[model samples]
Target: MTNLKLHIDYPHDIPIDAFQWTPETTLEPFHTHTSLEIGCCISGSGVFYFEQKCYTVRPGDIFIVNQTELHIAQSDEVDPSTFIFINFDPSILLLEDEKLLLPYSYQSEKFQNHIPAETSLACQLQPRIMTIHEELSQQDVGYLSRARSILIDISVLLLRNYIGSISSEQWRRMNHSYRELRQMLEFVHRHFGSNIQLADVAQTVGWSQARTSRLFREYTGKSLRDYLAQLRLSEVKKRLVTTDDLIANICFDCGFQSMASFYRAFHANTGTSPKEYREMNGLSEDFEKLGDANEKSK
Candidate 1:
């Protein structure tokens, strides 16, 4: 299956990020991130658009998204879904187990992306995940260490229950494939802000244009152009929220060839114009902070 190439530059200070939210009434655009994400449905029902299929999600249902796996979430608007998400770098788990879970996680056939409530493991995992959420929210002095411990326990459980060991050759193949994928993703990140094309990416990775395009689509589940558009949109979104740049300027700065295309693409991908998005996020006050600080300096 083609996976979406999602890049998340996580903050160094905190290697893991966790949160719970009731998705506001809309279908999230196709997206991916660098952190491996574990999600549990807290209430209501929803569907996760993943791996070119839809997986129904209900209360207590658990889903896993590997780093750079393209996916989207849509709640049943009438019922609405609340879900808790825990996103962490695999390296963070190695603090306890130096080897990490890489070996087990690579066992493709045994590893699963979704676990329904009917499963025995899911029954056991729901409560533990909730407890971890509680520990994080309360932040009772040693909560950070406590939270990490719980996370490690969860990782171990998943490895034991769902993953299987691979043979030497299989392990070597999977490792090499994933390393190449990461390099391709890094190339996309480095050049997305410029006039990067599929041909350019293919040449950079030492492949024919046709071969590169096909592989990119197969692995990412989206076209190279579409991924580039999403990447540009993300940058535009960031600039909209954090800076006072003009909309047209932000569009060009992020690599859109013209304002007409930018507006069309932004609205199609985000469901809102750039002006409306800024207002919806309520970041104008955040943008004003710089001016306020400057005035105080005077």
Candidate 2:
């Protein structure tokens, strides 16, 4: 399967993005991104694949994916599967309550991605997710605020379910990891454009470099150095879609000190040069409608 790290650019001033997703005729490559995604299967039956596990999904089932897992969903040939996906930055609600992110911070190997339709949580989540899509599409007064409130409520239910499923010892360990993960993510977001190193990140959590790297890789699926590069490349793609900045300038700003290295990484990961990616995804014509950039992925 292909390894594609999807770039999700949240529209300006809007933290949550919700949309209906119907699997296409062609297969979608296994992929992951920094954005936390929750998908509700609305119709038909199909298979959802993670790194090594596959779950059969039916109507009203819920799937949660964090930055750790590489995953995709495919509909059966005879009956198409359709879903509504809610995506947002992990930071969107971090400032409110770090525990709200606990559900998404699950260890991929042990986490349960699919919540069966028969469960109360699954039934509750499906309607709330649809409400999010409606709020986003309508954009009524205080829509975003209402949407975030709904998100928090949804997160709370997820948290309660997760809390009920794990032991107290596991909760204690995950709680510590959650705070550290948020710290690392925030620090990287602030200084990813600079010459930061593993030691610097370790300093944030006051842990040895080795231990820090181990935990980070365990949860994020990449080493700290590689994860930093991943963030840089994501920033590069976002700028390419939304701005008119020169390619070299964008590369350097995102912390790729060497233009050649940036170009090589870009080509290797995306199968397209920066120029081609931009040309295909650029919203230069209608800059204000920046939401168009996300259409490329659909």
Candidate 3:
């Protein structure tokens, strides 16, 4: 029942991945993974939602998403954008002090989720990001080594110029809450698809159920039930696009007990039926396969 969205399996060899996206891409749900993500808006425009904040993203905009933060991006349909995302494990790089960089740091007031293109920091990182993307795309002879070198440079840039420091008093005050919240998140991530309740999460984190409810809302701005539902719905959406499983099967596999419930939740989240969503995303091959599976099940 572990939610796949929260737990990521980094590759053993490189521990880095590069992604290119175009206008035709659909938006993924608000989710988190363990890898630190760095991205650049290569062309056009979009909006990036990080935690509860929204930032307008255009060409040259470089952003970072830490492992624990929930985020998503949507392209403007009229002037659709292209983006390049680089995700890497910090353990892959040699560092004097990894925590100074926001993405690698777990506790710091200076941690940043993104930088706008207008900022000087973004200006400095843009060319390096472009070079990384080029190296990844063309995959020249020493591309992997070159990419890692660039990543170290980017880390140094953030640590020296961009990241902020917090006083000891502030860190002590925030660290406990942050640790508890992260523990709760990890619990929910591992058991969201099961019959997990507030009491379970509360007990796991050694907080009262009422306090757990209040703190989760304060931290994430969503109720526990609502957040769990979002996780389930996100999984369903992923299967709808990538799997040939029947709708009913997917519904159950994603932890929805009934087809009606899954349908209602999916529509509420995406403003479209699951079938319609699959078709619109050019996943009709899987959609048709799902139909075949459904017929066989019937």
Candidate 4:
């Protein structure tokens, strides 16, 4: 039996993005902006897809997903799942004078060292995550400044403790595969809403169509076409939640050829029609509340 479920809602207004997700099955296909995201699993077991590897995550486990990684969360066992995600653009913490105080820069190769595994620093850094969340939720005047300070502290701790010790050989092996896969992923994100073919993606990544397809499947455990479709569907859902666009307009914007196809894909992926999903997830009320809150906060 398949118990696939999906939900898409923006839960916070602060630019230091945060959200809580509880999924009975798998999260919908989605990508984030150029921001660093760290997630901790509060309960249940699952695999997090990122950087061409699927890392098995359990309760108390924390993982980092670097900027621009295409990712999804799926529960492996038939149990409820819950997690908290904290995301922030690196610029939030890096002032000109304080640039050195911030941890590894994403622009440099150093940021890539923190993917998929729990480094010694990540272990030490895990406990403070709760404190950061609490400060953000308080949403006081100086909370953003406090959060930024905590974030940079965490990054410095991770770099000094874990990233500083990697050998050159190990770094090369990791970088080789990660660099290629990242190139392919960038292509997928750019062309997912168009009439993209596997050959087209292969050409963009400098691989043969067959080899590229095999590599993508091996890395992600899903066909490239299926991944692209899901990406498109996710965009459609986001638009439905955040805007008052017509269904037909959203369909075309998300690369669906017709309304029937759009409806079928939407229902199949999300277990509800687009309209139903939006209403059930509190799109109208939540958006209004969020806007008012933002205005007040400002």
lDDT of 4 by residue, 203-292 (tens): 876899989988776444357877677778878877877778887888887777788988988887878998887777545676789999
Best by TM-score: 2
Question: Per-residue lDDT for 60 in model 2?
Answer: 92
Q: Which ten residues in a row have the lowest lDDT in candidate 3?
A: 94-103
Q: What lDDT does the true structure give each of the candidates?
A: 0.71, 0.83, 0.71, 0.63
The segments of candidate 2 whose C-alpha lies over 4 angstroms from its true place after superposition are 180-298
**Candidate 1: pairs in clash:** 2-218, 2-219, 2-220, 2-221, 3-219, 3-220
RMSD of 3: 13.1
Please give the lDDT score at residue 251 for candidate 4. 87
Whole-model lDDT, candidate 3? 0.71
* TM agreement with the true structure for every prediction: 0.52, 0.63, 0.51, 0.49
Give per-residue CA lDDT, model 3, range 148-208, as digits (tens).
8888888888766643455566555555556667778777877866768889999987999
Candidate 4 lDDT (Cα, 0 to 1): 0.63
lDDT of 2: 0.83
Please identify model 4 stretches exceeding 4 Å from their true place. 1-123, 128-165, 286-298
244: Cα error in model 1, Å:
0.8
Q: Give the per-residue Cα lDDT of candidate 4 at 46.
A: 72
List, residue by residue over 8-48, the lDDT tens digit for candidate 1. Answer: 54321234557897765677567766567778898998787
